[model samples]
Target: GRALSELDSGMNRVQAMRSYAGDQLNRADRLESDMKDQALTQEGARSRAEDIDMITALSQVETQKVGLQAALQSYAQMQKLSLFNYIG
Candidate 1:
């Protein structure tokens, strides 16, 4: 009976250790998944920031082009109206 009890105690200890190890593995897996999700979120935010910057830059270029065209047109009109045309 004593030998049987000793064997049973050892088996129980082993089972407890196994359960603890399983729990630790599950915790590690959850942590790894959370990290991956955070990384993806950060990447998406960075991509959006870059896209906004590009769009803003494109809009500025278009505004500048419009201003330049208007200036050229005004210059052309002034050149056509010379001193002789204005005086007469």
Candidate 2:
């Protein structure tokens, strides 16, 4: 009779341990899913930021090109004028 009672108690302990393990597994799975979602969101934002940086760099280069062209044209026009005429 004592052996039978011991077996029953052991079985109950095992069942409780199993339930606790299952709950822990479910919590870990949810955390893994949330981490994956967060990783994707960060990846997308980084891609967009890189694209914007590239666009900004291209626009700056275009602006410099226009400014350089204007300076060259102005110098060419200045060459046609005599220095003495402006000094008089």
**Per-residue C-alpha lDDT of model 2 across residues 14-72, encoded as one tens digit per residue:** 99999999999999999999999999999999988777877788899999999999999
Worst lDDT 10-window in candidate 1: 48-57
User: Per-residue CA lDDT of candidate 1, range 21-65, in tens?
Assistant: 999999999999999999999999999877787778889999999
Backbone clashes in candidate 1 total: 0
- Runs with alpha carbons beyond 4 Å of true place in candidate 2: 53-88
TM-score, one value per model: 0.59, 0.56
Candidate 1: pairs in clash: none
Among the numbered candidates, top TM-score falls to 1
Candidate 2 positional error at 24, Å: 0.9
All models: lDDT?
0.96, 0.94
- Kindly report which residue pairs in candidate 2 clash with one another: none
Give per-candidate clash totals: 0, 0
Instruction: Provide the lDDT at 14 for model 1.
Output: 100
